[model samples]
Target: MAKLQQTLDDVRSIELDNAFYVEDGTWIESLTVASNTEFDPETVLEEISGVSLFYSSKIPTASEELEIRRLTILANESYPFILSLILRQEAIPNRIVLQNDVFEIVATTRDWDQFRSMADEVQETLGEFELLSVTQNEEPGEPLDSGRLTEVLVSKLTSDQLEVLETAYNHGYFDVPRETSETDLADELDITQSTINERLRTAERTLLELIYGPRE
Candidate 1:
């Protein structure tokens, strides 16, 4: 997927189905979710990438939506070792902040994509933000502080393995369709392909260890 860093301004929100979300004139760089609202990844991705990549409830009951949010939190906690990208919103003046494990971005009123309901009133953008999409944008030329999720992944790695992983991500080794081949990385790192593969395996194992932790 393409990573967008551009800011969008003066956008209104449209509510549909059982939920409400924003649609920007341009591709969305970030979106915020209130702590109180349910986190709907499908709705978020639909707005951002303009495509729905997962399941969402059509005839959703209030309890069902709440249950979905609970499930998301549970999944994140169950495997906290996995990197997560989160967008938090405040409602006072309509602001959005994007957080990765690494850095936080505070966007202006123009930055937020909010939920709209006829019965509800929005006083600020910072409060009770909605949950937007979850993505992996750990490469260069994307967003500043873009590597929060990657940092989560790195947190699971040893210092040395983290170096290798960071190199792979920054050098576009992990870009979709793969901008750099294994042979290219092998040449750049002056190591054999077998060695690179071993490093990657070791890194993955260590991350899983951090996540599951001895399985006891």
Candidate 2:
């Protein structure tokens, strides 16, 4: 069994956006974290023998205080603690975060066995484990990789269509109560109401086809 490592210290939180097993035990991971003190993950990573930095960005708060940082690292060690076994399952990790002292990992697998195996591994190595919630995705039998979600979504939707959809989503247009309407979207996008409707309709169709598989 693989042991869990603190991996990082002086960190408020860490969110693993995407990760992939390259070869051997090496893995590539992208993450965003918030820290209160002066803690550079790269320095700690440098301490490890087989670690390389691909990209890094630091974004501060409105007051110019360094609060959040994003990094993509390629390392033989699985950064936090979960990757020891997480990499084995090939599950699409949703959000892997370290809050306080506990690690919360949400991921999607093709079947129940895969999820169960990962959960089992966590319990064995991490000592403490919690099974929060497991529910089927909206599109049954349709498995979408987190990496491909963005690439495919962008390729299918034009910029204008994407902009409108993003605006609607940000303003809660898709809420059950319908927070915003076509007229509201048109005003926000500075486009005609008819155009707003058309863009949204087309975008929705393309998105649905991608998810549910094109209509026969």
Candidate 3:
């Protein structure tokens, strides 16, 4: 048992510099990569089952010579280690940030036991990469530093509302030049424009209420 625990700890501490875990079982990670590397989205999807390339866009930062690509990946069931864990229990892949060879993933799971089981499997299966740390949530998936107001606000949002909001954000509908439009988003989601609009409006109102409180 002691050896088992040590193995778990080692797996958890392997890629400390590149991976992070949130209390809510959410993992936000940054993968390392070589400079000037380009990725083909379809190829990447073929290689990894748990990750999906949602949208890819590039923008010039303050350094005009430097351009950064923002890739939004949805991990429904791709990464082997994460997939093993999710199969052991219920989990959700929140987000992924990919650059070159490095991939940053944000995922959430409510079951700790299943998570541990997944870690064990990762230790046995993944030999190329490392696992950094596993942070247990005080109140699964809730940020430790968040205020009560924020919690209440998030709690009030329905799954559909959250989905629409995330879709808009991911597709760059909210970007300055707008990478995508409502009609495009609606088509992607196979939902009507009116339904998407209503969800966005409701989600926006809920967020505003959280920031400024209800209207007088």
RMSD of each: 19.1, 7.8, 16.3
**Regions of model 3 farther than 4 Å from truth:** 1-153
- Specify the highest-lDDT model's number: 2
Locate the minimum summed-lDDT window of 10 residues in model 3: 8-17
lDDT of 1 by residue, 167-188 (tens): 5765798888788876777787
Q: Please give the TM-score that candidate 2 achieves against the real structure.
A: 0.52
State the displacement of the C-alpha of residue 210, model 2, in Å, after optimal TM-score superposition: 2.7
Most TM-score-accurate candidate:
2
Give the clashing pairs for model 2.
Answer: none
For each candidate, what is the lDDT?
Answer: 0.37, 0.68, 0.49
Per-residue lDDT tens digits for candidate 2, residues 4-102, read 125555566766666677887787877666665556766766766777878877643321223566668886764444755675677766656767767
Residue-level lDDT of model 3, residues 34-120, one tens digit each, is: 112344444644465444455554422222222233334444422454433434545554433333334334455566666665556
User: What are the clash counts of all predictions, listed in order?
Assistant: 23, 0, 7
lDDT for model 1, please. 0.37
Error of 3 at 159 (Å): 0.5
